[model samples]
Target: MAIPRQQLLVVSEELDEAELAALKFLSLEHIPMRKLETVREAVDFFHVLQEKGMIEAENLSFLKELLYRICRIDLLEAQLGSSREEMESELQLPGRAKVSAYRYLLFQLSEDITEDKLKSFKVFLGKELPKCKLNSKTTMLDVFIEMEKKGILGEDNLSVLKNLCREINVSLLRRIEEYELNLSGREEVLIPEEQKGSTGGPKAQARGQALSVASDSPGHWDESSWLEVYKMTSQPRGVCVILNNHSFAKARAAVPKPKDLKDRPGTHVDAVALRRVFQKLHFTVAEHRDLMADEIRKIVDIYRCKDHKARDCFVCCILSHGKKGIVYGVDGEEVPIQELTTAFTEQNCPSLAGKPKVFFVQACQGNACHKGVTVETDSGQQDSSIETDTRLQLDYIPAEADFLLGMATLQDFISYRSPRRGTWYIQALCQHLEYSCPRGEDILTILTAVNQEVSRKSCNKVEKQMPEPGFTLTKKLIFPVS
Candidate 1:
């Protein structure tokens, strides 16, 4: 039997350059370095695997494993006819994995290495690798390949890589150390299996005892259990600070003719919704109305100075007029969104480190209105007219980990509002939280639902609004409903 060439071609077309490089990197152990170097496209790499007998119609386990390892679950299911659950179960059997754990570790390191770190790595290895391979466009994956060719990095060798990571970023060294520990544990588990039925020495008996304990515990070897989740079980989960700027009278008075900042009338509805939902979720809600830009900074600093060691998370909702990278205060002053978010960084607020800090901003990112595309709807009814918050700007979230900034709309687009009803983004967000939190849905999943609901809505049959959620969360954040 032969695998369908058309299916491979279609899947190949879906892969971008980075994904192609990832697939090739994962295949280094199975295919020769020379063949992989010549394989530039995904289809060509698949052909090399097919020729090497690693993938065929009857045997596609290796190909499926490659796709699964690269986190391409979509392609694994749609094209390869294999699900993640099936792959997980199959890989549980020892020696079924074609990709070594060491290889996967290196690939993950490459993925996480920043561009600046990559340049540093190239400079450090300048004397070791060929000068031609260390160009400006060289990625971490390419650097890893060069190191492997130099015989410094391999399945059993990671000293050079560890030293490089230690110099570049101390935090990254933890990954390599964890990989080494897990690799050692796997070796201990395999000793008993390989030397079964022998009168093993004292060391062998101890290994057997360790294996017995591991076998008894179902989650002992479960890799997914290694992932740490944000602890959200505190009595009062955290504080929910709502900065509602409904009266912008001072802004209107200070700004000149064309740039008049109007009062936000319907924002109270959003504030009420947020307060109710977060309070129901057991957060201590603090609602501040009509604040100046300086006042906003002071309030955030007050919260930042608070002892949040017992808290599991923090939440802030800013409802005001905003421009690119800033929100306007009631007094017509600009407050940088980055400044507000960075106030809670680990350095400034050590008590809140490793906890999720969520910010939801309901304001126009810019003056430009988003035009809607025609879509078939089941409802025959239509809204004749709708209102909008005329304020405008873009958004900003800090680069640090464990922060999430949910914007009302994309940059340069005006978000919708109603004189009676709240904003399209905030209302939808509250609705999703109210519905999904009790069901144990994570924050990102809830935000995606908000995005879908808000994008479907249109004002005056032409203007549409799409919410955006940017995050650097390192774990699944599920709000406690009780």
Candidate 2:
């Protein structure tokens, strides 16, 4: 019943004047424009795009980025219906001053950016520019063009990106809601049909039994047990805690107030998608909304106090506002990362013992804003961290387990947020979890997907935050793809 197609080719040459103008706003140095061969296919693909939740526009630049961005208009539409006046007021407000303010604050924190170096940064912020398109075959440029065609660069209209970041950052207080969700219950992983054969069933049962015994055994075993027994099935336990923190009561003063931060429908759309995906994979997700650090310490303390009975693996998702190694409490206080995870340390909570402890922090790490990256012929040439202080202090701590740390951005840097939607890191994390978790994708595989999605879907200086994962697992995990 499905049409069979092969050697699918898509070329983007029918770019009209406006599209062409949009292209000039782009950095096309690395795009492989000459290799494309199917302009017709690309045009046709753009035609029915709206049916798949695409936004119908006389212009097709937006959808050139991701299938997900199309759903954003539905977000816009819902906002229109809820409060037209508020939406109009925001849209009409002057964003230049606010943008300048954010830029100033960021500049004060780090000298990695400047006005003279903001051309590429402006491109990421979605500023309008002349007509242009790719003129080469560089990988970075190629990826950027691909995203531009998908319209994933998003609307920089009225400085929406800054507003979005402010709005989403406020939702970090919702971490409490995540904790409640985790306390309520967790989804169970289902057995696959193919593995239902008699031999397979017994084999799986035996393996499960063996895993249980090994997981329950005490540490400090002889070298043989470490290699033969523990190494056979030892793994870091996975914990998912979704916390909601702070309130919009003290919202950012950015003009064009973010739609999602105002409780828009698309708020946390990406994060919810990921939670559901991970839930289906039997991840113990603690979905809390609006929790404070004192509360965070208390909850982690409870887990630490009961480490003997605590889960061997750990995954903590802190969805809150942050600066550098510190996240904001609902009271506007700073809570250091060391303070939060100290509960999991051997000195505090020894239950986790020698397992994997993973923390996925989805908040701005600092006030440092996105600066234009120097595009080089090799994409790998870009420095991973703009500042020497980018890596978290946890990197230096002698963690008991193979602790893995995942943060939204580098040091002294603010992660990108979607005014009414979720933070970029959270959204990407959730999407990858949904797409790959249920399929039994390994932790690394899912993280890879998250990295690719964020890198591909976003650009510009301020919005170009990526999720960085540091791990120390004894063995590789493949999430058991079914």
Candidate number achieving the greatest lDDT relative to the actual structure: 1
* Candidate 1: stretches off by over 4 Å: 1-227, 255-259, 369-395
Model 2 spans > 4 angstroms off = 1-239, 246-267, 307-312, 370-398, 438-440, 459-463
**Candidate 2 residues 325-421, lDDT tens each?**
6765544445787677666776666666665566777665433322232111100111233233533334522455556677666554445554444
CA-lDDT, candidates in order: 0.72, 0.41
lDDT of 1 by residue, 205-293 (tens): 10100001111222133543455678899989999999988776776567453235667767788898899889989999999999998
lDDT of 2 at 37: 23
Who wins the TM-score comparison?
1
